[model samples]
Target: MQKSKSFAKYADAEAFRAAMEDDVRRGRYHDPHQESRLFADVAVEWLHGKLDLKASTRSRYERELRVYVNPKWGAVPLRAITRNGIQQWVEGLTTGDYPAELPDGRSPRPLRPRSIRNIVKVVMGGVLEYAHDQRWIVENPIEKVTTPRSWIRTTTRCI
Candidate 1:
């Protein structure tokens, strides 16, 4: 496929071309077209590819995607997802600070740390990892996201 970009200066254009060539040579080049695909589209594609998952596991993943991950990221392009954005989303999930209206028309309640972590891991992480594997992104941004820690307190027994 033919791709072209116009730079303000000849030197800038040459530098970009050289970098593209170097990336190609190193087998690190990603197709720009794939980067523009919406997260929802990619997530569906990823989910459909999980033929080995049990029925219950697939159902859970679908519910998580529909309820948690998609509301925040569905329309976003693959190239637009960032580590910082994912971190903020995690914080919101823990703090009950997400949008008041979900696609299902219910208010979102704050989730427990473990639930939040599961959503991040099994939903966002899974889809983004698939995107990375498909060369839609240079790297998986979810790798750097930090989930809220679940603090457990133990009471001491006095004899």
Candidate 2:
């Protein structure tokens, strides 16, 4: 058996080791250095690999990745994506100081909670779906990360 690697300034070594053991024993943890890929990478891979989404979906993910996920928590590995990060990312997108610049040279409007929630939905959905396919995770992380569902419905204005 190969030895498990450790990170400096990284907490929860034992827990990670345990999860790794589960991965290995369960036949899920391939690629010895899975630790190198961050949630951002996983998100991109998930978006492309797992989703049969449209261009709009891809664009939205690109925007969110560039604006929010990449800047804030891109360096953090997938194993380290806790509910706290998800919560903070959602808050940052909606109520917090998190907006990316637009082509018009202005910061895009901040995402509403619902919109952010949907993004979270897509992201987590993709993550867990992939996890399921890989047999690494049996449950979605949504239960762990509490998110507010957007109650906004349709609105139309036409001349």
Candidate 3:
């Protein structure tokens, strides 16, 4: 992870603190999309490292790639993923088809939507937003799918 230089060159104590506070007061916390958008791999790499996030956030990205992504189309090249394909992927999650790995390295039951939605909301959401900014695609795959505070549960199990 790289140190944030988004705020710099303020020598005073109170004034510097105030200016930092102002940036947060506005909705301008971090702008990851201000860089090049045509390169998908670069954006992915940056999302893994360049973004200044917490440990749990980084773990969420890993989960997004593993639980929600890799078992299906991860092997395919990034350019081959079309808009419709992305839509289908999101829909697939609703069916509890997500693969799972046991602690003993054996494959377990597929994950429910409740387990999958967090990765979709946090991890995949960031990737889609970054891809949109990079101009790698016309629009974000996860666009219009708002993140919820809590996922809905079903009678059978967690949904």
Clashing pairs in model 1?
none
Model 1, position 111, has a per-residue lDDT of 93
| Alpha-carbon RMSD to native, per candidate | 3.3, 7.5, 12.7
Cα displacement (angstroms), candidate 2, residue 75, comes to 2.2
Clashing residue pairs for model 2: none
Candidate structures ordered by lDDT, highest first: 1, 2, 3
- What are the per-residue Cα lDDT tens digits for candidate 1 across 103-122? 55677889998889889977
Q: Pick the candidate with the highest TM-score.
A: 1
Report model 1's TM-score to 2 decimal places. 0.82
Give each model a TM-score.
Answer: 0.82, 0.60, 0.50
lDDT winner: 1
Worst 10 residues of 2 by lDDT: 134-143
Error of 3 at 53 (Å): 1.3
| Candidate 2 TM-score, C-alpha based | 0.60
* Model 2, position 79: C-alpha lDDT score: 54
Q: Which stretches in model 2 have alpha-carbon errors above 4 Å? A: 1-32, 99-110, 128-142, 152-159
Better of 1 and 2 by lDDT: 1
